[model samples]
Every structure is written in C-alpha cells, then in structure tokens.
Target: MGRSDVRPSRSSPLAWGVLGLWLLVVVLALPLAGQLGESTEDEGVDYLPASAESTEVARLTELLPGGDTTDLLLVAQRPGGLTAEDRALVERRLERIDALFDVAAGDPAAAGVVSGDGGTALHPFSLGELGEEEQGQAVGEIRELIADPPQGLTLALGGPGALGVDAEAVFESIDVTLMLATAGIVAVLLVLTYRSPLLWLLPLFAVGVAAVAAMALVNGLVSWFDLTVTTMSSSIMTVLIFGAGTDYALLLVARYREELRRLPGAGEAMAAALRGCGPALLASSGTVSLGLLCLTFADLNSSSGLGPVGAVGVLCALAVMVTLLPALLVLLGRRVFWPLVPRHGESRATGRDTFFARLGSSISRRPVTVLVGGTLLLGALALGTFRLPGPLAEQDNFTETPASVRAMELVADAFPERSGQPIAVLADADHAQEVREAALATDGVAEAEAGREGGGWREIQVFATDPPESEGEQATVDALRERLAELPEAKALVGGPTAQTMDLADTASHDQRLVIPLVLTVVLLVLAVLLRALVAPLLLLAAVVASWGAAMGLGGLVFGPVLGFEGLDAQVPLLSFVFCVALGVDYGIFLMHRMREEALNGADTRTAALDALRTTGGVIASAGVVLAATFCVLAGMPMVVMAEMGFVVAVGVLLDTFLVRTYLVTSASWLLGRRVWWPGPLGRRPAAPGQRAAVDAVPAGAGPRGDAG
Candidate 1:
C-alpha cells in the first residue's frame, strides 16, 4: 500500500486524457437540462385519483344516466358575511371558469354551481378524466382566469386535481431545501476534515462534475428507454452524489496525507496517493453501484427509478475521484495543503498501542466482557421492534403539515364519511350487477355509486365511514373485495386510498423478505473475496445486523413514544437495513483489509489488529461524521418519513464507524488470535522472512498490556 511501489507521475499524458474525458462528458450533458426541469403548472384536473382502479370506475360511469364526470370543487369565502355583491362576483367568476374549459354542454350557464353557508359558494365544473399534462394545462388556465379575482372573495380550489398541484409545490420546496442543506453540510464537513481552503474545494468541484455528468447520462438513458423520472429523483440524486462523493474524497485525501508523509516531494506524493487509493476507490464504488442495482427488484416504480439513478451517480463519482481529483492534486501539488506541511525527516507514527491501543488490549484480555456488554446494549434496543407499526396512508404522509392537519379536522367535522377515504372497485362486463350489489351490501359503506354500463362490466365507487389507513377501514375493504370475488359475473381488482396503503404494506413486506437476505449474501461474498477469510465476514455481518436491529429499536422508541406518532414509517426498516449493511461493511472493509495487509507482512495477530485500527481509525471517524451530518439534514423536511430516515441513518453511521469498526472488529480479531482467519490460507503462519520476524517479536498471551516501541 506504500506510495513508492505504485505512484503515477504527475506529468503522465494518460492522466490528462482521463481528466479531459471527464470534462467532455459533463459538457455533453448540459443540453439535457431542459428535460430535467420540473413542471410548474397547477391544474385542478391533476388532483383526482388516477389509479387503475379509479380509471375503471370512471370508464363504467361514462355509460350511466348523467355520464361520467369529474367535479372541481371551488370554495370561495369572504371576510364578513355573504353580501349580494360577493355572491354576484363569485357567480361571475364561476361562469368564467366554466367557459375557460367549455364546461357547459350547450348553454354556458348550465354548469352546476351551489352556494353554501351563505358566505361560501361551491362551483362544480364537469370535465371527464384528463391526462396529467392536460390536467396541468387546465389548472393553469383556471388559475389565470381567476388571477384578477373580485374583491371580498377569496377562493381555494380542492379535490383530486388540487391535491396534485399542492403535492407538486410541496415537493419542489423539499427539493431545494435538501440540495442547499446537503451542499452546506458537505462544505462544512470537508473544510473541517482538511482545514485547507484549497483541499476543501476539491471534493465540491469533483462532485459537481460527477453530479452534472450523472444527471445528463440518466436523462439520455431515460429518453432512449422511455423511463419516467419521478418527482423524488432530485432528492435521491442529492443523497447519492454527496454520500458517494464524500466517501471517495475521504479515501483519496487520507491516502494523500499518508503519501505526503512518505515521499520527499509533492509531485511524488500526489502520484503515490492516486495510485495507492485508486483500486480501493474503484472496489468501493463497484460495491455501492451493485447495492443500488438491487433496487431494481422493487415492485414500486418510485423505488425502481432510484436504483439506476443512484448507481449512475456513484459510478460518476468514482470516475471523478480517480481521474479528475488525482489530476487536480498533481497540478496543485503541495499547495493543496499550503498551510499544513510535513516536517522533514519525520517518521509517521503507526500510533498502535495508544489509548484505544490499551482498550483493544483490555478487550482482547476479556473478550467475553466486551462481547456480552455489546450484545446486551443492542438487545435492549431490539425490544422496541414489537411496537413497530405499518405503512401510513397518503393523507397520513402529510399528517404533520398544518394545512393537511387543518383539512383533516374540517373533513372530520363536516364530512366524517369522506374524511380521507376514497375506494374504487372494478369488475368485468358480465359481473357488474352482482359486484355492485355486493359492494352496496358491505358494512361501513357510506355511499355506493353504480357505473353507467349495463353490460357485464361495471365500476363501483364506495365511500367508507373511516379513514383509509385505519384497521377497521382496511378490514371492511378486504371483506368487500372478498365478497365481490365470490360473485360469478365479475373479476375484481380492489384499489383506491385503502388499497394503495395495502399495496405499499405488501411491497415493504416483500422487499424485506427478499432484499435483506440478498444484501447480506452479496456483502458476505464481497467480504470473503476482500479478506479471504470466512470468520471475519461472518462476525462483521453479525455486527451489522445487530446495528440495524438496534437502529430500528431506537427509531421505534423515538417515533412511537417520544414523537407519539402511530408508528415508524414502513420504509424505515428497509432503509436502515440497506444503508447500515452496505455502508457499515465499508468500515469493515477498511479495517479487515488493513489488518490482513499487516498480517501478510508478518505482524502477530494482536499487533496486526491494533496497528490496523491505529492507521484507519481517523479516516473512518471523519467519514462517519460527514455522512452522519449529511443524513441529519433530512430531519428538516416536512414529511415524517424523511425525519425518521435522517435520524436512523445518522445514528447508524456513527455506530458503524465508531463502535463496531474501531472497537468491535479490533477486539474480536485480537481475541480470536490466529483463528480469526481460520479455514483460510492467511490463518496459517506466514512463510516470508518479514512476516516471521514481525510475528516472533510479538507473542500471543503476552498480557494484553504492552508499550509501543
């Protein structure tokens, strides 16, 4: 791992070519910026439920008496009581809105309009189901029509269409917040890590190039394959780019510092740093990319989209880290660390047998004490797992927001049956009557509307008496679905607010059942190949699982009792499992790799474990701090899911870097002695002269307390 064996000269033409290609890709992707821009139009039609189940109901309704129609609920209020002028003005505006979308069948005044509570009026605009783009356009036209609205009349539009517009606006704000927060965190963390103005800028610049290039590449791929990017893609990019970029940057700079200590000149040090850290960076990036690729297995479109986009960002960051970062370092040389210089003729201290040195020694002396204490602490946290709750409904997703909370309150008061409940049932042409009859007979059905079609296929809409996410509501829907299934005429697909919640719950359950084992297997294979030892990966996997369970337990405590939320987000466990397992293995890899390297060089088991921690501990700690801070910013988002995710990831990374990798791995290696690498060739005594000499000087069972010479 030393600089002298693998250093690449700064003046090499190969390095410049790599840098040039990196710049070329970035420049090429700039043209696709328009494709990445989010839609800003607010449309009333976009707020309606457009799921497969909803669409079937709408299709069937088209054949009914009045025909299938979508209603736009226009709510208008005034400061005082309703006046003649206020009513007149609202009537005029409603007429205008109806005209904007050709709402009237023949006469313009035919559009349905109702005045409610004397002070407020509800204007219902009838439009059939509209596509997303069409709905966005319609909403924009409606907004423009009311732009110069009359005095004493304040208007707010709601329904399915309005919800869409509000969701888009909220999502946009979240995007901007996450981006700014991530950038601020990365900047501060890098500055603290390097304490050099120039070095601090390098990661930002590299990641910037990587991000731009990755997005452009993703855009091109999406266009070519006809893949749609979700509203959440930008947020995913923010996390992946910053997280991977920081990881890569840390590996490079840590190596750079080590090289500077070893080499006599800056050019040599820069070259050595790149060459030494290059393979490790590539290996790590590959693993992360592979881990993200696993997201393709997800049944949900949102999660699947994240897989490739996240993988692209990681791959791009790796390219920049290895090529552009190294070239820039070469060009800057010692000036990259201008204020901090290496003292001439100073030998870098391995720092083995320090405080952690004595700690590891003590743990090795009493392996049972260390193991028992760690297990008890983790197990205590695991007890909270039983209290974990299921996935929340769409309304519950925004339950923390003031507007949503207020809206829920109003619905509960005025329209309890309609409070956050929308259900749709679909059946084939022959079974429509039976299905509709069964649906109407179902208990807790507040209202059941039959479809227009007289043929076998008929769509039914059922409004439930309870909120969609409630257990009673779900049980009612499940019963209705089962009874409908028994009807001879229809083949039913049940979906709507309650159905979507159930679908998400099923998806999360399926993902956990499949993904956890898959990820663990992949990680084990990776560790096996990297360490060439079976016991190490097994122990490492155990520690990672323990950490994940502990994080879940802690999250349950926070969200369940402390925050007093119904339950933790359904996706929290999945997120914790993936991130904690994948990222936790990173620390394991860093530790075990260094330990193996030392052991191969002939150090005794105890000395090799201690020395490996001494060398890799600082970088691991710095990396954990940066990653933890970056994840912590998610707490500021409006959504409860984001807040819970942020907290868990932050805590998980801290435990992984500090507690597990530093103390646990080192102590386990020391206690296991030579058997740590058992059933592997490395477990056997080294045949090399250097290894024999190092091992003989440090004997096993030499009383874990010793001085570093």
Candidate 2:
C-alpha cells in the first residue's frame, strides 16, 4: 500500500523523445490554433436541427437572389407623441438608410409608417442578399449611420438581422476571452492545489499545448471533413482540454510523488507512476470522448458538431498529458516539486492520507446511514427542477440585453398587432398560390403574400396574428404546418425565426432523450469492463446520474433566484448531462480502480476500501476542484447557454467528487462488501474446505476488522 514495485530505468530515452516530438507539434499548432476561430460558424443553419423544416428553409433561402437576406426594422419613438420635427428627422434617416444599403426590392415600409398612438414611426426593410460577414458589416454600418437621434426622438434598430449582428459580436470575442479566462482559472487552482508556483506552470503549459493542438486539429477537421464548429463548441473544447488535461496531470503527478518515496530515481519512479494510474487515465479520457461523441446522434447541428469537436479535445489532452506532461516532469526531476520535494525512503504516513482514512473509518461505522442519507439529499436537490424557468427566448439569450433586444422591446410596445419577423413558407412554384391561400385561411394567419421564386421553389411570407416566440405565435406556426400538409403536392414548409427556435427546442428535447441513455450506456459498459464487475458499474452509473439531477436542480435554484436568468437554454440540459455523466464518473473510476487493486492484492474489504480512499482521495479532490473551477469559467461568458452549461456541470463534478465518490460510493462498497464485485471472481466467498480456491479467494484479509471502522 505504500509504494509500487519499481521497474528498471526505461523512461529516459522515451521521455526525451516525447519531449522532442511535442516541441515540434506545439510550434506547428500555434498559427493553426489562431486560425480556428475563423472557421467557426454561428449561422442559423449551423445550429438548427439538420432535418427540421427550419433547416431546409434556411438552406433554400440561400439559393435566392441575394444569397440569404436579413430583415431589419427602424423604430423612432417619443413617449408623449411624435412631433413634426421627429417625423422629419425619421424621414431623413430613412432616406439615408435606403441610399446607403441595398434594400430588398419590395418592402411594405419603403416609406416609414407612423403608429396610431402618434408616438412611434416604424420602417421595415431587408438587406439585399449578402454573405454572413457582409450582413454583419451592413448592420454595423447602419447602426453607425443612425447613431444618435435628435432630442426627444428615440431611434433604434430592431429585427432578426440586428440580433444576428449582436450575437455574432459575442461569438467573435468568445475564443480569446474564453481561453484566457479558462487558463487563468486553471493556473490559479493548480497553484493552490500543488502549493508550488513552479510545479503549477508545467501542467498549465502542457494543457495549453494540448489546447493549441486540439484547436489546430479541429480546424483541420472543419476544412477537410466539413465538421461544424460553433463558438460555443470551440469554447467548450478549450475548457475540456484544460480541465481534463489538468485532472490527468494531478492524478499522474500524485502517483509519481508517492512512487518517489520508495523508488531511487525519477525516471524509475515516473515509469511506476504511469504503470499505476495509466488505465484510469485512459478509461477516463475514453469515457469522456465517447460520451461526447454520442452527441453525433443529436438532431441539432450545433449539438452534433460538438460531439467530434469535444472528443478531439479530450483525445488531444489525453495524448499530451500521458506523453508530453510525463516526459517533461520526468526530465525536470524531483526539485520541480520545489519547497516540498519528495525524497527516497520518506515516511508514507504523512497527513495526506490521514483525513480520508478518518473519513472512510467514520463512514464505515454506519455505512447504511451514510448511504441512505446521501441518496435522500440528492433526491431533495433533484426536486429543484420544478423551480426551473421556461425555455429561453431569442431576445433573452444574452446575459445582458443588447441594443437589438432593446429595440425589440420598443417595437413590441408600439406594434402589438404585428410581428417584425415573419414566418416563411416555401412551396413548389406550381402550388404557390394554393399554399398561400391555405396559409391565409389558417386560424392564426393575419396575412399571407407571395415572395421571391427561385430554383423551382416559391417563398411565401406569412404574418402571424401573434408576436414571435409567443404561445399564440407557436400555435399559429403549428396550425399553418398542419393546414399546408393537407394540400395536394404543395410540399409546403413552415419556417422562420420562431419556427427555427421551436425546432431547436424540440430537437434538444429529443437529443436529451437519445443522448442521455447513450452516454449512460457507454459510461456503464466502460465501467463494467474496467472494474470487471456488474454491481460496481451500476452503482457508479447511478451515482453520476443522481449527481446530475442534483446539480441541475441546484442550477434551477441558482439560475433564476440567484443569477436572475430569464429562462434555461434548450441545449443546456443535454450538454450538461453529457459532461456531468462523463466527467463525474472520472473520480468514481479513480477511487474504484484503486480499491480493486487493493482487493486483488489480498487486502480485506474494509481495509481495501479505506486504503483506496486514503491513498487516492487528496489527488481526486484536487482534480475535481480543477475540473469544476475550469468549467465555472463558462459562467463568465455572456451567452446563457454556455453560462448555464458551465454552472450545472461544475456543480455536478463537485457533488460527484466530494459527496458521492467520497462518501456514498465508499459507504455502499462497505455495505455490499464482496457483493460490490458481484458475479466476478472477487465477489465469491472462499471455496469449500476440500476444493482449491481461486487466486483471490483466500481469506488472509477477508474479515472486516473493527478498528478499520
């Protein structure tokens, strides 16, 4: 239990080679990593459900005359009423807008309209087909052109086009901001955990190398395989590399430090450390990578794209942590630990294992009480889900209200009966008239009109009687789809901003149902194989799942009442669950694997459990804190989706680490004893007196000694 048996000095040449190879990879990765942001796309088609009606419409819309068009509403208002000067200023601004930008050919508001309340004037226009980049530029220019309105006249730009511009701004800045913030968080945590300024730099540097390499590789995937990379996916990838990479470093380094006490040389000690903890590292990485890859089955394009992007990150972190990190550490030798370096033949009974040993003893004294208490606590926390808010609306996606959202509010106040964004219905040109008539006849339709025709398809712009994303608006969209479906050969598709949001939300729900089970199954099978037991994997799986529920419930409690967020994003639940199950299971693997090793070495069940907890607990706790803090970096992001995801996953990791893995799993193991490994060789009681016993069937350390409690 004190130290691993050291092998010959075999790591010198391998370490040097790994170091050399990593230096080269890092050099090549720098520029490519910088270019990764350029490849990310935040377009509607990039995030919409692949097979949804909204996605198809988005695709076909690009085939129209001006590429994909953007619509905008220019609003000018005064609280009391619009005066003559206000109208004149608005008129001049409208003329300037028309002259500067290529307005769509046919617009109802080519000339501005005054509201009946006499306090507002609205002008609606669409930019002629422009690329995504060009669209953002156009919106920016328009905002600048109409920067400050005359006194008493409030001029604001509002529409889907303006909203996209605002969102793209956030997306553009996310990469640099996220990387810096995540690095800072990890650096701080590592320094605190290691209590060594010098040692912290090595893991942080190695993780940074992994991040750059992952980014370069991900960008290559985008270019070659047409993988979708969104700002959120790319940001999460950076977090995964840093978080998972640092966790691996902590586990490996802790084991190496332990080996250092018994082994004479650093090279020999590192080899033993790698031998001891390598399986857990590989299993941990594999579980996370495969769990994320399950996102490929998600209907949402963003969710599916994140699968490979995140998997690539975890794999890159694994590669670098095992090879580059170990190589660097081995070459640096024991002094790299500085101030508190481990020496040969040092005492094994340091304070490191004492706390966890005492904890294990306490839990073992009343295992059933501990187990039942933990379960009830998790269940009570899970009830917080009932307090969760509704699905986030488009205008509420940002943590702070951008100008576009402000404009939307202003427009909504003035134009209660009209929606600034219209629902688009695409149909066969042959049946355009019939589809339009049917749409007009639909219960929620206020008006329907023919739009551009291209590529054997005709676009019909349908205005709903209700505002966008409202219950009434969604109902209208549903009614239109149903009404249009009955038309003979119409092949009509209902889509628009509202429809796209609906599709994304529905797809998220479907993805949660699909991906959660896939992630659980993948993680369970992995645990079963690793532990070589049925009962243990099931126990760990249930622990992480329950931990997820508790974390999400905590999120529900925090997101609304504490954070003041309006509602949860559609993607948060699925993404958080994936990370929680995958990453949370990591600590369970570490603790259980060590316990199994002890049992295999012929230690009694009680002693093995306590010893595993004693030896691995500190490092596991440090890894958990690092992972949790890294994820908490997401809370700094402006996007609600990322913020919520970061909060839930971070909470779940902490709960799994400090609560379930530390107490619940240990207590359960003590109670189950050999049954914890049921159906496996280790699970069986000693053979009958006459029969030969299995290799691990001896009762040398089988009894639960009272002092172990």
Candidate 3:
C-alpha cells in the first residue's frame, strides 16, 4: 500500500475550477475594501490634566455643575511671548477644531478654550463619547490645521484623540512589519531548503493565494459581526498562512523526492507523495488550527478576534498545500531538483550532517547527563521570571515617534494629576442622587464629577491621587464600590483607567488558573491520540512546560534587571504559554513521527533515534530558525510590550527546537523503544508480508535517482 506504483484518482480540472472560482470571488470582493476603509468613532473619553494649579479649583466649578469630564487637551505654544495677534489666531483655530466634533450639551463651558503658562494655550475639546475612528480623524484634522503653522507659534494636539491617532499608526506599522518579516523569513527558508529557485517559489505562490483569500474573508467577518478586527490581524494571518503553507510544502516535496526515485514517471511520483503524506499533513494542520481556535475563550476582544481568523488562514493554507502544491510539483517534475540531482550509483548519504542529530546521539548515549544539565540550565533561566516588570508606561502602547514621546512627556509634566489614575463610577439611573451622595462620602476620592442626568441613570468621574494599577488605586475602587452598594438607589459599576487595570489583573488571574489547565489537558489528550502512548505525551508535555517556564524566567530577568522594570506584563504569561505550547508540539510531532517510521522499518531503538534525528533535524531546525527570526522582528517595534513578546517567543522557539525537541524527546524515545506505543495495536510485531514488501520497496537510505551509477 505504501509503494510508489499506486496512483490516486486525479481531479485536475475540478481543482483548477475551484481555484478559478476562488479568484472570481476575490475579484468581486475588491470593491468592498473601499467601503471598509472608513474609520470608526471613539466611544469613550479620556481626560488629561491642566497645567495651572488654579485649574483644579476651576475644575471644581465644572464638577459641581454636573457635566461630562473634559476628554481633549489642545496645547498651543509660541516663542518669546503671545502677541495679541497670536492669541487671536490661536483662539480662532481652537474654536474651529472644537466645532469639528460634537460636544456634550449639558455644560457649554466644557467646550471652551483656555491658555496655559507663558505664551502656551490649552483648549479642551468635548468628544461626547465618539468612536475611535472619529477621535482619530479629529486629531488628524487638528494636526493638519497646525501643519504649516504661523510665525513664532507651534501647535501640539494632546488628549485621547492624539493618543488614538498615535496608537493607530503604531499598530499599522506592526502589521506591515510582521507581514514583511514573515515573507522574508519564508523566502530565505525556502531558498535554503530546496536550493532551487523554482522549488522555492512554489510555496510562496501557494501562500500568496491563501493569504489574499484569508484577508478578504476575515474583513468580511469583522464587518458581519461588528467586531473590531485587531491591529494584529495581519501578523496573525502572516504567521498562519506562511508557516502552515511552507510546512506542507516541505512534507510534500520531501516525500515527492523519495517517490520519484522509485516511481516510473512524474505523475506517479506526485500521486505516491500525496497518498503517503497527505493524511499526515491534514492531521497536523487540523491540530494547529484547532489549537489557535482555542484562543476564542480569551476574555480580551483582540485575542478572541484572532482565533477564528487565524484558524481560517491555517485551514486555507493547508488546502492550498495539499492541492495547489502537488499540482505545481507535478508540473515541474525532475527540474525542481535540477543542477544537482543525486548520482544514481552513489551512496545516498549527503556530507551535510546536522548539529541536532549529533546532539541527539550524544543525549541518547547519556540521557541522565543530558537531562540533568538541561534541567539546571532551564532552572537558572527560570529564575529571571521573579524579576520581570510591569508595563514601562501607559504611552508604551504608542509608537516612539518624536511627536508621541513629546506628547507623553508634556502630558506627564503639565498634568501630574492626569498622568495615570482616572476612574468612572456608574450607578442605576433611578438612584443617581443616592449614588452621587454615596460616592462623595467615599474616602480616598480626591474629587467626583457627575455625568449627564439622563433617564435617572448616573455616571461620575472619580479622580484619585493614587497611580493606576497600584494598591492604592485598587483600594479606592474597592471603597467606592462598597459605598455605592450600601445605597438603595444605586448598583455601582466602576470602570476606567484604574478600574480597567484591576479588571485586567483579575481576568488574567482567573484565566491563568482556569484556562491553562484546560488547554494543557486538551493538548495532552491530543498528543496521546497522535502518539498512541500515554507516557510519551505526559513526558513531552512536561518538557514543553519546563521550557516555557525557563523562557518566561529569562524574559523576566532581562526585562527587570537590564531594563529596570517592575514585573512582567500581566498578559505575557498567557500569551507565552499558548505560543510556546502550540509551536513546541510541532517539533515533538516531527521528531516522533520520524522515529515511529524508523522503528516500523526495523531499526533498533537507539539506531532509530539517531536515524530519526538525522533525517528530521534539518527540517526542524530550518522551521525553528524561520519562526524565531520572524518573532524576533517584533523586538524592533517601538513598544516595550512587543519587544518583550518578540524576545520571549524567539527564545522559546530556540529552546524547544534545540534543547527539548532534539535532546529530551529523542532521548526519551530511545529509552522507550517499542514501548513508546505500548498498549496500542501498533506496538505488536511487524507482519511478515509487510516486512517483505517494505524491504523490497526501498532501503532505509535511498537516493533520489534509481541506481547508484
């Protein structure tokens, strides 16, 4: 059944028809891109501090009046002094900007302009709870208005609007960078793997088609659900499409080379390769796609959005790899491996031995030495986790452009009160008065401003002296919630910068406690089914977990001591865990699959381990190198969070491929021998006829050419 003579039914015309239909659909969807280009509106307001000490006193008047909090701060500065003409020009420009967006009607004073110390001026624009896109546009227009500027005077837009604009730009760069990096890595890997330009181009073409389709589909889905397609969608798509598509191509081509050596013609070789490897490719892709789909359980909207879209890309890539790749390979034939076809009579052994195979052999010879040494190294690295720090700053989310950094520094300097801590407390509409009274009575609340009086529901702005995410901030939130609960008329909903920090912490804690175990359990079960051995899965999972802990610990150490941060970002653990586990499994799968094949073909346990590593190590190393390089590019991003993520993933990939997958997994397989698949029917001795057929088909080491000429 595994012979290269048998051919599966060919559906070339049907395959081409489907490809044509997919292209037609994409061509039709191109028009929708224009409609989707429109920006969204900001739905909330973010308040910044005023430079004047007396502004706080003035703020009290607005608070007493019961109006929405100021969400925009416009800063106008002029050298030397503000002349009468400069003041007039600044005021007129500020008024025009303020009029561009709708402001709350309750307090008209909230929409006015004010001047700062020296020749600088400030204007507070009322966002009236606009969406993100509107806020961005408003900021863009403000920027455009001040682009040329008048003599001696410069304008700087500060507030949530500016922040939104900065964030959007940063995210856009991240998307573009990730895509380009993934493409570059794939191109390099393909060139290295095939050493043939034509073969290298095949995977790229297949992935391109999958990528275009995946993007169009993802955008359509985002529109259908009114979901915010995360700024990371492109990164997610790049990883899925390129990684999975290239992986499939590698498997197909590797098998195709072997089959062509035995089969009479190119068509027979293609059929044989597809029949032998197609099912395995499908299974591997299915596992990965499902793993990514598990992210839908993430509480964060951004992560959840990635789940389905990433899954779609992976599935599409798999389809293209199986169908399109094979079609292309059949068309190219022996020319795909031209310029260096193996001499028919020569030994199949290539002089290029891999480092991983040598390392695996050394480990098999001394598992205890390898295991202990590896564990200690990992343990030392894991110590770094204790020193990891929290986010560097709130502005760390934005790009490190001069404007953004200057805006951040200016905001911090001019408005210490608005630097971090801000909260919004809401209560039942019917109990607005009672809730306001309760809130006013709460301790640690520096000031409270009531929101618009509408339908008996009330929202209040609470400014506290404590920094956001600090113990004091949580205390203020707790005290306010407790006070509001005692009021008969109000059920308090506390949410804002400080509240969001607390909520994120709480959500992360809950997810870590619940989601990790659930995901691990699922992964272990899947591994068990694939390996047909409970022991192997357990041990493999243990190795992966250790590697993950070590990676995090190392990240924490670098970020804390070298970078001088407090602790790791709250979300880092979850993100790292998911990425490490899923990608780590790919290495384990490759190694174990090769080992199983070797054992079934009559190699001894030790020999099989060596043979498996020798055959599969190059592929695994190439894949790991590409993945690590792609992830490492994230460090180039301006945001510290992205940099940390990039470093962590890069390290994890290296550790999994080099240390754990090459040494630990191979050593364990060698030790287990035939027992690796114990209790399964596969564990039994090979059938005589099967052994005879396998021996007749080909030797363990065969060249791509028929005879050793």
Model 2 bad stretches (over 4 Å): 1-11, 106-110, 129-134, 350-353, 685-709
Candidate 3 residue-wise lDDT, 62-132, digit = tens:
34323433355656566565677766776677666656657643222232333344555555555565555
Residue runs of model 3 more than 4 Å from their true location after superposition: 1-70, 75-122, 127-137, 144-155, 223-228, 342-347, 350-357, 391-393, 399-409, 415-421, 468-470, 560-569, 638-641, 681-709
State the weakest 10-residue window (summed lDDT) of model 2. 691-700
For model 1, what is the error of residue 482's alpha carbon versus the real structure, in angstroms, after optimal superposition? Answer: 0.6
The best candidate by lDDT is 2
lDDT for 226 in candidate 2 is 93
lDDT (C-alpha) at residue 475 in model 1? 82
Clashing residue pairs in candidate 2 are 66-129
Local distance difference test, each candidate:
0.66, 0.86, 0.63
By TM-score, the candidates rank as 2, 1, 3
Whole-model lDDT, candidate 3?
0.63
Off by over 4 Å in 1: 1-10, 37-71, 74-156, 265-271, 343-345, 352-367, 399-405, 417-420, 451-457, 560-567, 686-709
Q: Highest TM-score, which number? A: 2
What TM-score would each prediction reach against the true structure? 0.84, 0.94, 0.81
